[model samples]
Target: MLLRKLVPVFALSLASAGVSADRLKPEDAVEYRQSAFRLMSFQLGVLNPLHRRQAYDDEAFVYRAETLSRLAELALEGFTEDSKGQQSRTQARMWDEREAFETRLREFAETTAQMAERSAAGDSRATRDLFRQTLQSCKSCHDRYRIE
Candidate 1:
């Protein structure tokens, strides 16, 4: 989790593992937030079909869940700035209701982390249930705090 602490610092200079070369403007911050979520979605998305089809092996599920957990960590960091610009769906309440937003964000992150642990333990049922719980938190937060 040392990486987590370093992300916001690197974000100011806007550099990480070949991610960005230029300094981050507020608009760039907005893009970073969106891109982080998109990547999180993609990680979950790949496993979704396997979930429905019940076709994936235990290793795949664990790997994806672990990846999802890491991505969730990255996601919280993206919201460090009050980034507002065209195409940003972030509501003012993200900054205004910072405590509430962070409360839910932490809950979501913890849920994903739990999923990773359960998946790694070979508990597919618990992992899948945790995935639903995680998704629900995502929806609930977006419903109240995101712009359509």
Candidate 2:
């Protein structure tokens, strides 16, 4: 009887844990842009901590890089759709810039993945260079597409 009671309690806790792990999706353009921005912030938060000499992990570095890349791509994606609002900062020209933005994001992701591989192989210099390149891409996209 005690075992059966414990099983249900354990299963309920596990189910709740999974629900808590689920991320909330943004429902509008403004919220989507802000979500993208927050994702980039999170990537930046993880980068230095995961990439430093004493704190490096190839898997973690790759994960953060991939996350940053996805956020950049999503930022552009949010702009491509019509934002049914009068106060959107998304320029009409963003549709034209979409392809280029996607290319840059892909390149950034690939470079960072390479950096992770190099880090795994113990190449510190390559890792640093790749990290800089990744940051540059983020800045370039934000400069062109995002408005305060």
Candidate 3:
């Protein structure tokens, strides 16, 4: 019982040991946020063809969905401080409408997480639907808050 109690405390401490989000330098935050999106894109590439029936890699689909969920979370963390740099596609509106930006990221993460759960259960239909919802969330945010 003591070990079990200690284990919970230890786990919480370990989880909280990650670099504080606000400690990131502006350029580092901007670069990491963009990199997180790229990672999500690569993971999506793994799922898309299989999802479209061009491939039958069910295991890859599940793995990619799980990865995308984590990537969404990472993206959220990276965007914690709106540090749009010279090379960033993020719009000034992101900081201007900060709460809305956060809402979009949260929705994306939630939907992607649902997709991951459905993919793990081998439910292609639900996975595909949730995947679309997650992408729609991305597109909606990009439309409003990203620049080409």
Candidate 4:
């Protein structure tokens, strides 16, 4: 019985490891960009509804904040390398604006972290403010780096 349970668990772990080992190639840039954009949009969608509420579940806020942080990190990573095609949505000035993009990404991450911390501390007002600021950073970066 123990062996049976252990075998299935081991197989599942191996399967997941194999799936994760498939690195993103330049050919996959479009899909990766879309996926990352969707994640950011989803996180912001959640925050939009919560802005009017005075109090929100701390755990929920933290979860969303973490998601935003991860999305920002992924956005930075996605732009690190070149795509296979010449018609990418990435801006032509990305190479020149690299430093500015990195700064904005870091600011988004820091603001999201602050939001998480404030939410955990039960500071709704601060959390809301930080969330808005983080959203603005995301918008600014997208406006400059993202073609659409």
Candidate 5:
């Protein structure tokens, strides 16, 4: 399929770009971050019902968790100084308190990574716990750093 071929090429381009603040436009950063978050939310939303029903599709859950972990890692890169003035839900306080925001982002990335590892290892209980923690981390960060 065209998609199968293009995906690798697209990924190669992104990898070669080694995206940095200087390389990203403000609007592009906003779009990139928003897209990453939306994709992550979609993965979590799927996982949520499965977790609640205690129905584990082992391979699917691992796939979603791995996707979420990758997205979490990519998400923070969108918060460039250039993106501050863009029309977005990101709070000024997030940019103002850069250290704290970065810390929270790091924690989120770590949590998602753990969730993926647990899922892959067939540790359902720990995966569920990490899922809850990941959701809580989103709420906690949103409360402080995102505008409604």
Candidate 6:
């Protein structure tokens, strides 16, 4: 709900700011992607307690899930050919096996979006299951494509 409204505003702000993805240097793209992932990691911190049933904040969880979903959508845009050789945890195989790598990213995006929807619907069980799938997606990609 809030995310839906905020997204257009965010896009308009970025556009007005003249933030051109294509104009970014390779290292800039690497930094951009890493920053998104770092935020995603921060958002994921809520999952452990929620999964354990020790804590549950519906509003916060929904917001974080939606934010994570949006970040997943943006993350892959940073994997440009120009960014391939930048110093990062990204592996050469991400480029060598671009199709497979991208497929994994899409999977992550899908899982996150589903989790967000479930969270918004107040379905804790489904949200928790989807969250685990989201974590597995991250682990899968990291195992296959990240250096460490």
Predicted structure with the largest TM-score when compared to the true one: 5
Superposition TM-score, candidate 2 onto the true structure: 0.59
Ranking by lDDT: 5, 6, 3, 1, 4, 2
lDDT tens digits, residue span 1-148, model 3: 1223322222112126675778777778877878989999898777777768833227677667767776776777777554654457878888788888877776676677667667768777788788778768777888999897
Residue pairs in candidate 4 whose N, alpha carbon or C atoms collide under 3 angstroms: none
What shift in Å separates residue 145 of candidate 1 from its native position after superposition?
Answer: 1.6
Q: Which ten residues in a row have the lowest lDDT in candidate 3?
A: 6-15
Q: lDDT tens string, model 1, 6-67? A: 22222121234455323566676667768878988887787787678663345667667666
Clashing pairs in 1: none
Q: What is the C-alpha RMSD of each candidate to the true structure, in Å?
A: 7.4, 10.3, 6.5, 8.1, 4.7, 4.5
Q: Model 5, residue 120: displacement in angstroms? A: 1.3
lDDT of 4 by residue, 16-120 (tens): 445431366765755675687789889877777776664544566766876777676565555545563546777878767778877777677668867867887
Tally clashes: model 2: 0
Steric clash pairs (candidate 2): none
Q: Which of the predicted structures, 3 or 6, would earn the higher TM-score when compared with the native?
A: 6
TM-score on alpha carbons, each prediction: 0.74, 0.59, 0.79, 0.74, 0.82, 0.81
What is the per-residue lDDT of model 2 for residues 1-148, given as tens digits with 9 covering 90 to 100? 1223322222122224454212323346557756876887888788877656544445567557656655654554444344434356555455577767657655765676676666667677787788888778777766886565
Model 5 scores what on Cα lDDT?
A: 0.78
Better of 1 and 2 by TM-score: 1
Could you give me the TM-score of model 6 versus the true structure? 0.81
Worst 10 residues of 6 by lDDT: 6-15
Model 6 C-alpha lDDT per residue in residues 13-46, reported as the tens digit of each score: 2335665679778998898888888888888887
Q: Among these predicted structures, which one has the highest lDDT?
A: 5
